[model samples]
Target: MRTNQSSQEEVEKTLQSITGIERASPNPFFLTRVEARLAARRSAPGVTTPWAFRPVWVAASLGLALMLNVSAVMYAREALTQDDQEQETVSLSAEWGFDATVMDW
Candidate 1:
């Protein structure tokens, strides 16, 4: 009876060892596709960018920014000057060909 019990345990162990051995992996060929894509990318020609590191673009952007800043500053100064001149009487002389008679105090 003891020998019979040992044989039964050996049979159970052997069956457990081979469980799921026939199961196929999902998408077993995925690595091959990835490697092929990588190889193609490596062998392909390098692309040239027509506008990368362009000096003209850099210069133009800088010039536009500077012009905008100067314009804004000039406008702000002009507005402040107009506000400050409200209490004064501006007189236009005949040398400039204009009338000079106005008092807005």
Candidate 2:
């Protein structure tokens, strides 16, 4: 019974050794690295745009389209004389075997 009581006291002392431990501290640069990562993610680009959809590109495209339309209208208006147009229509009709006055609709 004497030896058992001594062993019990030794076990109690060993268990009480854990109460003297201090609070744990993290690494000094760990929080700084985590904050820097969060800041980088916030500043990074989430959506990217193409260059063709920009205002200057759209304006240039529209101007080019207008220029083509104006040129085509001018060419069609000025290139054909009345006599030449009639002759061309006659020639085209003869080539295609279509009569100006036909029986069937």
* Top TM-score hit: 1
TM-scores of all predicted structures: 0.37, 0.36
lDDT for each residue of candidate 2 in 1-105, tens digit (9 for 90 to 100):
999999999999988997898999989999999999999878976545678888999999999999999999888776677668878888887898988456365
Tens digit of per-residue lDDT, candidate 1, span 1-105: 999999999999999999958987769889999999999888875654457357898888899999999999999999989966743423324455544564344
What is the TM-score of candidate 2? 0.36
In candidate 1, stretches whose alpha carbon ends up further than 4 angstroms from where it belongs are 1-52, 88-105
lDDT of each: 0.78, 0.86
Error of 2 at 69 (Å): 0.6
What is the lDDT, from 0 to 100, of the residue 73 in candidate 2?
Answer: 89
